[model samples]
Target: MDESGSAASVDVVLPCLNERGALPWVLSRLPQGYRAIVADNGSTDGSAELAAELGAMVVREGTRGFGSAAHAGLRAATADYVAFCDCDGSMDPAQLPTLLAPILSGTADLVLGSRQPRRGSWPVHARIANVWLAWRLRRLTGGKITDLGPMRAARREGLVSLRLQDRRSGYPLEMFLAAHRHGWRIAELPITYFPRTGKSKITGTIRGTITALRDMSAQLRSARHLCRGGAAPSVRDTEEEA
Candidate 1:
């Protein structure tokens, strides 16, 4: 139901890259009434085909990046609300309705699923980095947002209104900070987390973790400066200038 108290369509965007191993379960687990859009980012394992065969609308993103695929899916969505979830099976799509409740009720502009990590589901070092980033966000927003999780739901138009610029690991951060700057009411809901079915291409290895930290930290720094100056700056824009 949307804020108008009527039924609303939802589009769930699953960013894919050889996630064929997990697609079946992930797609199957999506809450009823939610349409799946698998944004395949150059997957070589026939992930796109499998997703299409599984009845999901598959959109190919040649520009390979989490943000590239996610943004593409967002653009393709015609639903009243849009959600993003990892195709690696780390998150359960059944909980999406809970996350989206706030928005549909007009209580929040954006809602993020805070991961309640199960043992071995999250690496200690990566947890530390995530903690630091969350702390930075709290300091910037003065709100209690604990996790920068992949599972989130928001209005499709509000997201498009942000004109989010990042097409990499920084995309999530960029979107969060931009929403804050635009005075969006952001909220978080806790969800159970599990180990990914396949090896994570990002944030599962040292190199990928480092790259994420680099991008996220840059976004944090830019947001900090924005806080001081009341200017909404973006990480990718700052990097492009350099």
Candidate 2:
């Protein structure tokens, strides 16, 4: 794995809230040698215990937001490279190595997995919302990336240095925007997206998708406003609810 030798040195952070039903398959499919750190965000469904029993290192994050759980795992990671994957069955951990290829080969500073959703994977409303967000991103940064996805990989130190601030649904988009603002080389690769196990919250539900769209739209507006004013907004410049 890019001179890092064994893949054991890579840590995969799986942020979870209530993914107890999907824990088994998600943890089981992690590629050999990659460590799984499940950051549990108040899962009353026993998700944290289930992940621990499955041999994943579990960290309890009290804050109830995707970014909080994600950031906590990043701090807990002791690996050369880190990957963020959904604990739900939608994303396959096996595809993480593909996302990390650019980082490992020094071809990119940040690599995001552009999901090629199979049937029944992504809902129409969610997909349309993502299209709008991606279009806004292109207008702001003129970058080639078309999808802002959750499955992503990057060197631990460089990602931490981005100082990403959003703790809610906007977290992933904030990471993308920050990388562009800092002139980090960003790349995207296609990954298969499947229907999630159990009840889907953010992407599957209309209310959840609207919540995420509002958060992301705010981030985009702030970025555009700042960029037009001749100043790239710092990570903290956009104040958002975690």
Candidate 3:
């Protein structure tokens, strides 16, 4: 373990929706000393209760979108840094230190976990979408990001300073784009991706993919406009049902 891991405080945010079956496993694997916060998006499966029982701080977001829940968790974070990962059993919390190391060492402001997918971990359609999206992001931001995988970490204040406003799947991409525009140093580290326990809310169906693409397209356009000297778009709470 790095010495910084012991000194730097971090809060891991798990944005979940009806992930009761996987929450126990995910929470159990979290490293000692890191606060875990579960952002529940109105789950009927008692996920919030279970997470709270497992010693995680549970924040309930009334809205129903990935970005809505994620943003709630980020706001609830009270540590020097915040780390986010899916609570669907696909990402191992034990590997969180890998994402935190660079940020703790002052080498990077943002650390993205590049997924090394296990067999059957990533569907073909999802893989294609991720590849294309990553390529487009690299082009737009002139950054070397390869994967927009969910597992990531960054300084809490820096992330909040970006003033991200997307309330859908576009949230992650918007963060990267804004970080790039602000000249924040970003780095990617490979992490294992396991098969999830439940059906995916996004990337599992064609409709989900299309909806995510639409949201991302809008964010990309805003990014381009900002890069061309246009003023940053006003932040608003817009909900998209996905």
Candidate 4:
């Protein structure tokens, strides 16, 4: 922690979308010692106003994609490290230290928060979709990306290098592929996951499912082309294959 009460000199970015129902609880749970910024994706629920009231610098993302909102938040960050997460309370903010551990210790440039073993939490369709997407991403990137969980930490420079391309559903997988292609050291830490409050914006809908599948497939195809040039071993690859 620093004198300014942050775990590291990094900034935390949360992307919100009418998260007013649960955003405050998430904010309150953030490790007291950290500085945070909230990027509201044109929420009419006063999410931006509420976040401002809670002392988080709020940036507006008129575009309505998870990646777009996060990118907007990342731009607002001015720190050596930038961590991005959803404003939903499913992820534990207290475990931020564990997620940032690899980066802080110089072992990794990107830190992903993997969900611990769980079942019967979310709808069966969501679970299945998550598993399928993760499997495809791992196969495409040759990295054992266990979960597409949104809680992630990364060094600012490497993160910027990723140049996250997807403005929608494929963002996490796209970021991982970009990092892998650029030889950024990536690591993951197990974190708890729970069903979030409020209706999910991405599940149990045909459009959502199609969008996720299309985006993942397109990104994976592009990643294959990128990997045909060369391959960098992933931390998971070394651990498992060795």
Query: lDDT for every model?
Result: 0.87, 0.85, 0.87, 0.74
Cα lDDT of model 4 overall? 0.74
TM-score of each: 0.94, 0.92, 0.94, 0.86
Please, what are the lDDT tens digits per residue for candidate 4 over residues 52-158? 99888889977777677878888888888788777877776778877877887788888888877355346777678778877877777677787777789988877
As a TM-score, model 4 comes out at: 0.86
Alpha-carbon lDDT of model 2: 0.85
Candidate 2, backbone clash total: 0
Residues 1-242, candidate 3: write the lDDT tens digits: 34533556789989998899999999999987788899998898999999999999999988888899999999999898899999999999899988998888889999999999999999998888889988988888778888997899999999999988898888998888888888999899999999999878888877778778777777887888888899856434335565
TM-score of model number 2: 0.92
Candidate 3 colliding pairs: none
lDDT of 2 by residue, 1-242 (tens): 67556554689999998999899999988887689999988888999999999999999977777787898999899898999999999999988888888888899989999989999988888888778878878888999888899999988998899887777788898889889988999998999999999898677777667667767876787688778875644444223444
Candidate 1 segments whose C-alpha is farther than 4 A from its true place: 3-6, 230-234, 237-242
> Which of the two candidates, 2 or 3, achieves a greater lDDT against the reference?
3
Selected candidate, larger TM-score, 1 vs 2: 1
Candidate 1 local lDDT, 95-212, one digit each (tens): 8999999988889999999999988889888889889889988988988999988899999999999998778788889899999999999999999899989888878877778677
TM value for model 1: 0.94
Error of 4 at 151 (Å): 0.8
Error of 1 at 28 (Å): 0.4
**Separate clash counts for every candidate:** 0, 0, 0, 1
Which residue pairs show collisions in model 1? Answer: none
